[model samples]
Target: MVHEKSCLIDVPTAEHPRPAAAATLLELMHAQGEVERLSEREQLLSSLLISVNAVLWAIDWETRRVLYVSPAYERVFGRSASLLLADYREWRNSIHPEDLDYAERSLARVLEQGTVEDREYRIITADGQIRWLSDKCYINQQVEPGKPVIVVGIAEDITEKKQLELELHRLATTDVLTQTSNRRHFFECANQAFDTACAQGAPLAFLLLDIDDFKEVNDSYGHLEGDQVLRRIAESGRGILRRGDLFGRIGGEEFAVVLPGCVPEMALLVAERLGKEIQNLSFNYEGQAFGVTISQGLANLTEQDTTLDNLFARADTAMYEAKRLGKNRVLAG
Candidate 1:
């Protein structure tokens, strides 16, 4: 049998190249360009991850292994990324004891819910500083089935935000001068206490106190001394009052206390104790020394009392009577 001869084409020289060869060279150049572009993009992403303030982390859910952690982990958590990668428990150890259970449970919820964005907790840094974090985590959708589930999260430092919130609350609810509850906050809390007492038939007492001859003190010793007296009285009241009692600066040179679970007799004792404490306080303006006193009106919850205003009115009347009878004493309404 005769075999057909296979056709052979001449190989192209460097000077005289074939069309296919040129096309292959062009495709190689294009691929090289694409690779360089990819490398540049990867480098840019790495730089961004390093520079960001938040910590980015990925972990194997089943194995409890840290797969990857960004450089920011060291800065934010004050721990090395290498340690975290070696064992995911490093992250747990950093979390505050009070928040550990919550942080873990919230992270686990990502398995069912696919995401948990409102995860906030406190962490103790390696330097022994406590910091707040707003951690948002999610399940990795790209994780292959039968392989360990992957979880990713970003934790942002929220310590400053929490501190600002606390300061704002203090400004809103606290008296700037005495550091006691402000008038609005005092009345709000007092009204709630009054309603609770009325509902449970619990004994409640209200005490209204005014610094005796406060304007005269301000005029005589100057307003600065008057302010000192107010602050001292507030400090004394806070020290003498029961733990559960509510105290506030209600008006100019006036303070009020809400005594829950205190009967008239016990309330009188509290008032007397507070009065004596104030009576003991002495002040000196330049070379001259002076003492201060308070007029207190104590009112107890009564069957006829329907609102805190009722108690306030009766206490106000009694306080005026105390002023009339002579100050530095407690009187019941």
Candidate 2:
């Protein structure tokens, strides 16, 4: 990515013309020679730029053999280009097992539509290392004598970029402390669940949780201690729940969980699991260990519901009832 300065321009030191006409002619000739050399150097640099960084490949349509592969194959695939040239199947084998199906589909679509499909795939090196590769291939539309319609491709290594994108999405959707879904992502997924359940006439449920005496915990200890309690409780909730559940921190001491394809009874069981887990939890904040409990509320999404607010209000009311009835139980409505 770093480069040294190139000598594309040369300036003469003299501010004025030479004393004699012969001297002027000599200066002009020298400048002309420098210009010609630079032009040739530019062409060489262009070739190196493509040869070093880009992977160029060609496939013979009639024989279905790999006709050409640049030397960059070793730099990327950790082996000689001749391996793939001898048999295209070797190249196919190098592709990731999971991505093979997608690549095949794209190839088929290209042959049928005569339009290139831009895609990404995983490649395995000679040392059994995996890398993310991006490919750009288009069909050669022009016809020529004694040659089949060949597919030309150029590829680059984009593993780092892909990793960064995945990391970003994870952070954007997950809570920093407990690694649970944040409020924004939770609502989006829960709404989708509602729509799907409505179309299928399936039942859905909602569970609301609130930490008992959270303010007292923060005041008796400190904000840091309170944060630890929150994290521990959130983690316990996540561990107790199933993958089909949607859990998120909705407020400082409040959380919401959605259960899809679940009725009121199953939802109550799930809420009880979370509450029991929290009651068993012991926090060691600042070396002072203490116990904590949670209150939960459950609601079933009936076919008559129109908006999320309707379900949320019922869950909220039930949670308050649980809190009023001594704070360590699940209240269902």
Candidate 1 lDDT over residue span 152-182, tens digit each: 8999999999999989999999999999999
Clashing pairs in 1: none
After TM-score superposition, the amount by which residue 173's alpha carbon in candidate 1 deviates from its true location, in angstroms, is: 2.3
Query: RMSD of candidate 1 to the true fold?
Result: 6.8
Per-residue lDDT of model 2, residues 146-198, tens digit only: 76888878778888988999899999998886678888998888889888888
Model 2 pairs whose backbones collide: none
Superposition TM-score, candidate 1 onto the true structure: 0.79
lDDT of each: 0.94, 0.83
